[model samples]
Target: MHSFFVWYRVNRDEGDADMVIRGMMARLACRSGVGGRLIRKRDEPGLWMEIYADVADPARFEPLLRQAVDEFDVEMFIDGTRRTECFLAGDAIPAICA
Candidate 1:
């Protein structure tokens, strides 16, 4: 399974970012069957992250995620581009990397 972590820095005064993010997450869950968790960085005002774990189908999830971002215009609330990372369990790592 795959897990995705996406982080970004939001615009400081954007009070509506949370609402928009929640809406996007709902849309993503409905469309892709993947629910996400949103969190803020400790002691950091503008840093936030969204985590989606146990993804069995990254191929299907990725495009839906991109689509949701575009549909919700999530970039307007952020200072820069969002950064996304994917991780696999330690036991699932490829033999070539071991």
Candidate 2:
């Protein structure tokens, strides 16, 4: 149960941003058995993505991340911000991340 937070600086257009998000969503949805969301900035100009996963072993996601990069076609221009939080439980969750 490793939790990951990913923030992506993306193109201002909503459609372009979805390309990266959709791909990551597909893989994480299946592998982690968890769902994610796409957040567009209200006052700022970026995209934020977050995920929760039941990891058998956290290291296993390394390759998956690479796969997501390809599947999402995340180019160098899209800078990713990530933080790995402690493992998850039902109630300790933050609705922002949910």
Among these predictions, the greatest TM-score belongs to 1
TM-score of predicted model 2? 0.60
TM-score of each: 0.88, 0.60
lDDT of 1 by residue, 1-98 (tens): 89999999998555799999999999999998999999999999689999999889999999999999999999999998899999884565566763
Per-candidate local distance difference test: 0.92, 0.61
lDDT of model 1, residue 51: 98
Q: Summarize candidate 2's per-residue lDDT along 4-26 as a digit string, tens digits.
A: 55566765555666765676777
Model 1 alpha-carbon miss at residue 28, Å: 0.2
Model 2 per-residue lDDT at 35: 63
Best candidate, lDDT-wise? 1
Off by over 4 Å in 2: 53-56, 76-98
